[model samples]
Target: MVLVQNTNWNNAAKALKNISTATNFQLDKILNLSDKELEKLVMPSGYYHNKAKTVRNVLGMYQTSFSELKKLDTDTLREKLLAIKGVGEETADVMLLYLFNRPVFVADNYTRKFFSKYFKQKFTYASLRKNIMKNFAFTVKDAQEFHALLDVYGKQNK
Candidate 1:
């Protein structure tokens, strides 16, 4: 969520690297940091304060029920994630696909634009997600690659 929310990819990557290094990529260590420290760590990403809060909030949720969340069906898991602040549909789908290894397409703005250009159709987030899931048969990896490619295409076109 922090990585793609309003910030450019390079800035987000730098912020993520900084946070990972400081926390040794450990969730507990990150959670242990004071909010100001967490905000400083993610400064490069911009919107550090809100991003820090979001990171804390989502990780707090994970720290408590990660295993239980993983066991949930995709729909239930998506709903649970969506309920968290700062987790939009794209971020929720991202966690479902990458973290949980669920087969889901992230119909983010990039994907929406890609489809609009090539398919000559404009689709809302839910509509495109539903259309892709219903019409295409993709494994988790395939969906990941497709979303990445769409992001790459969108970036290049921009």
Candidate 2:
């Protein structure tokens, strides 16, 4: 669910460490900050400044309200995540499918490209996701495995 390409994690950690060096706040405190506060805390990370605020707010809301995010039903959690700023259908679907073990097909550029080439028709994200779910054997485990296999095949072919 936390799809950091190894190098990105190191870079992000280093940046966070630099920010922490100046601010006395701990990681937990920073993470729990309100949306506006978080926007100020994580400044100038390109477009991530606004995104960080949304992420923090959503996380804080879930932490305070749910106390255990993993316990929420996938559909409920997806809807909740979608309500947060900066979290669109793709992000919500990623959290539900990857993080919450829901049966969902994440329609990104790669998915769209592959499907379009195979089907010879342009497909929107909603339509593509629905097509996969409706046509394939719909199960969380199966969706996960199929997605993984598709990624592997894509990489190999590339």
Candidate 3:
């Protein structure tokens, strides 16, 4: 979901899928790629240099395969990723929701402005997310998808 974070230019998902397809969705394959190679692959996503670095850095820490990554619990994985420099609340939440299969809602700037206006409630990354989970965590995947769909709607309406 690092790709989701960098979707400012072009179609971000396509750019990311291109890189994933080139590397065959393998962590080690992507890690073996030099910075320049990864940068070029991600150039269409915008902020190629920094986004490439963030991807490499995250993959560097997670050198093992996805099967191994699947063994970790959501909180442990979230804690580890959050400790990384490039991972923020939204990015970490994305990793937790999408990658770790946790029921986390990624609260972006859109979430804040939209929720504040509509719900008449102030929010921070922490508080808004807490309330979202409190209200929507009736089931795991459902809650995760709700967040994703909400984000897409917010972005489109903006």
Candidate 4:
């Protein structure tokens, strides 16, 4: 959740480090933190308060249904993640692709922009993801690399 809507990789990494250090990488400890405490730790990541709440909510969901969620098919898992308060289509697809090693493409802004600029085509999240997955048989690693390459290229070009 920390990476969702966050662009500064350095700040995200620092926030992760702070949280992990404070909690000793323990889920129970992280879950026990007060909102203010969690917000303080994640302050560098921006939108600290909302992000903290999202982090807690996502972790709570994981704590409760992690094994079941992991076993779900890609579409099912994406739907479940989308049901969460802070998880939009991009965040849901990100969790599906990265956390579960699902092959669904994350139709994030970078992907959408890159395609739209080059192809003169507009795509909604579902349409872009569907079209890409339909056209390419991307393995987990391929999807990861493709997403990373798009991000890097987008950053550089911008």
| Alpha carbon lDDT at 131, candidate 3 | 81
Model 4: lDDT of residue 37: 97
| Number of colliding residue pairs in each model | 0, 0, 0, 0
C-alpha TM-scores of all predictions: 0.92, 0.65, 0.79, 0.91
Ordered from best to worst TM-score, the candidate numbers read 1, 4, 3, 2
Residues 50-72 of candidate 3 have per-residue lDDT tens digits of: 88888887787666545666677
- Model 3 / residue 107 / CA error / Å: 1.0
**Candidate 2 has which clashing residue pairs, if any?**
none
Top candidate when judged by TM-score against the true structure: 1
Candidate 3, lDDT over the whole model: 0.76
Q: Candidate 1, which ten residues in sequence have the lowest lDDT sum?
A: 1-10
Question: Which of candidates 1 and 2 is the stronger one according to TM-score?
Answer: 1
Select the stronger candidate by TM-score from 2 and 4: 4
Q: Cα RMSDs of all predictions?
A: 1.5, 5.0, 2.7, 1.6
Against the reference, the lDDT scores of all candidates come to: 0.88, 0.65, 0.76, 0.85
lDDT of 1 by residue, 1-158 (tens): 65667778899999988987898879999999999999999999888888888899899998998999999998999999999988888889999988888989899888899888889988999999998888767899998898899989989997
The residue-level lDDT of candidate 2 at 52 comes to 67
- Candidate 2, 146: how far from true, in Å? 2.1
Candidate 4 lDDT, tens digit per residue, 5-123? Answer: 76577888888999888998799999999999999988888988888888888899989998999998887888899888777888887888788888878877788889999989898
